[model samples]
Target: MYSHWARFAVFVFCLTAPLSIAIAESDTGKNNPANLVGHGGPIKAIAISGDGKTVLTGSFDYSAILWQLDNTTTNKLARRYSEHEGAINTVTFIGQNSRFLSAGDDGGVYLWDRASDNLLMQFKGHQAKVLSLAVSDDGKLAASASWDRTVRLWDLDNLKPLAILKGHKGPVNAVLISGAGQQVYSGSYDGSIIKWSVKTGRQERPLYLHGWGINVMKWLPGKQQILFGTVNGDVQIFDLKADSIAKVLIPHQRPVLALAVSGDGKFLASGGGDGLIRVWNTADWSVVEELNLSFGPVWSMVFSADNKKIYYTGLDDYAVAWKISPRKIGQEVQGKFPRRFQKLQNMSLGERQFARKCSICHTLKAGDQNRAGPSLFKIFGRPAGTLKGYKYSPGLLKSKIVWNEKTIDQLFAIGPQHVTPGSKMPLQKISEKNKRQALIRFLKANTQ
Candidate 1:
């Protein structure tokens, strides 16, 4: 997309400044968050599978990792596509649906069979590192922008060079193929955005958006408007058909380096040298949400299939995934289940103790099924009979114990299973009676 956006000072390695991550779901349909995915290295680029079942991310660590979307704590790494000499700079979903293409400074493009983590094919044509990549709408061709000052089109099926479109006087920085697959647009250091006829390999339009080199450009999905950023600080939106500015926006406090739009095209996000990614409402050009990259300069950003999450890469060592809707400090609320406190709000001493000692695998709800242990919300005022959906120690289940204050005190002293028997609560005790009493009070408050 190319209108005009600006640039700022780049963050070098070892840069660590504190920036908080926050979210607001009221304007959109987002609700309380459920989970988050974390990456091992500074994430450089990210792409989501069409079905939203999987996510693809490229990192400065020289690896492209595919992640299953459903599991949050499950950081199981699947399909480590290796072969590139340098870090993977971009990964995009193309063709039939789950198919992916990854390219990097190594000047290599590798097609991947996502299900098997298999390399379908590799294409080499660029003389230098491929800086950006785009897939044709019909998925028949993949276009690569490179420092070599050339945009090479590769046959998607054959992994062979279909054609080389050369015109940029300097390293090509960005590329986009129209959804109709009839046109290709490339931006370069020469400070111009050139549209090319895909059928004839000829330049169609060349629009200079800024005085300086273009750093990034993206086409708004299903529209004639293109959004772009430059080496200075200007962000502009243009009506591609008319070649006029539709809107000029302040996308970041600094240079905008990366951009991604939500599937519905209602929201757009920009990553910049300030190590921050800002989200905006497209219809009104209002700022919606902003995220700060804690470790590195934000290199890229991507939305998940459900649009419920956005993932970004920084220059740091790992990728960071964020919940589309998160409860912010002072905005936390009690949910349908007890013991589910809103984020960052002050909790009772008892709740703090429970969180520290027992929340690792359990959800504190009355009827919810156990995670690693049984729910205990309704246990205080109820009999200690074996709960359904839980495996109980034999001695405690048949004990038919009553939950009395004295009983709780004793159980906190001796083991609950030893005092009763069928209890499966791990062996844990508070040596201080006052702390034990406080925890019991908190548990009792929620149980009622």
Candidate 2:
């Protein structure tokens, strides 16, 4: 049995921030500022402290930084941990804020004593990247989901492997432990959700299927329901007792990547590759707010302890926090670029078209971090994979094509797959010749 208030406490502690906080005033006269902005690469994971005064963020730069949260002043980075050899995927604060665990692509989990900034212990068992982690309410048991398609249980009290629960056919992406620490739930890219008994290491019968690969999931506090975000961009609520999907939401246009529920069980937030975050009223399941992040796909999101704010990471290096006000529903917040680049805002028709379409995944400025796509700075004459620091697909890396006007036009005319087979770029084909020419013109203008 789960107590709502107690589960709320656990939710606050488990869900997971830093940079010069820029104050972006909304047109509604609301001051909704981006709370933190200092990661060097895309942020992969986020967790807030039990006290709500601190935040932890994991990034593709192979580091996790702890930040002090202050509303009145800009949040400051408190500590930087760089022991991991690969991109960090999941981070969680255990007990209070003093102890924390981070899992990375290196297939290792490291526990740290935050007060002393010391590495307390390291646990390794998974054969592939660990995608998600959950700690029991008592902080005695830990569950980790990995791309190896197994969920490993750890005895946190003894710092040893307890059990390995294997059943999923594809990579396990999400895991959650019951408040009492008796049961564990895991979701996988195979589209199945499996429940396991922590004590017996036995899985329950009758798997719940999502029809699409699950990307992220959350157990509702004080309720027998689980919220799942799927690769098909559907958000499904599955009832544990009824063992079926009670509700299905299609709010996003692309794959859903992150999900978070309010600590008090009043609201639910889901973010997706469509660059939108939708907030729903839990009582009626009606959408109360929709935030357009405009940065690329959102990879992670977490609600503030008070439930009045949401901190999320997207394709950008910086993790952003937005203020939430139920009274001000349907309000919009526009993205703020640096003031020094205001002249770039005077876009021609071609540039405006590119800004509306291509700007979400590609930055025009030089020296900026890569987003979903590589920066387009000086892209006109560069080779496909010549942009340094971006992880290019094998096909693009081995290609001999230079990004001239004709090649750039061909890319959108037939799609990246046709232009360069096996490229990881999403399937987006701009069939209109004029549109492609306009886009190419904008690219040439910006790159020059």
Cα lDDT listed for each candidate? 0.66, 0.75
Worst 10 residues of 1 by lDDT: 1-10
Q: Which stretches of candidate 1 lie over 4 Å from their true place?
A: 1-40, 71-76, 294-296, 326-448
TM-score for candidate 2: 0.68
The CA lDDT at 150 in model 2 is 90
Error in Å for residue 29 of model 1: 26
Query: Which number leads on TM-score?
Result: 2
- Candidate 2 least-lDDT 10 residues: 12-21
Cα lDDT of model 2 by residue, 81-141, tens digit: 8767567899998976668999977789888887799987889888887989999888888
- Each prediction's TM-score versus the true structure: 0.65, 0.68
lDDT string for model 1 (270-366, tens) is 8776656677888888987776644335677777665556766554333445655551433311112122222225777777767655553355666
Model 1: residue 147 alpha-carbon error in angstroms: 0.9
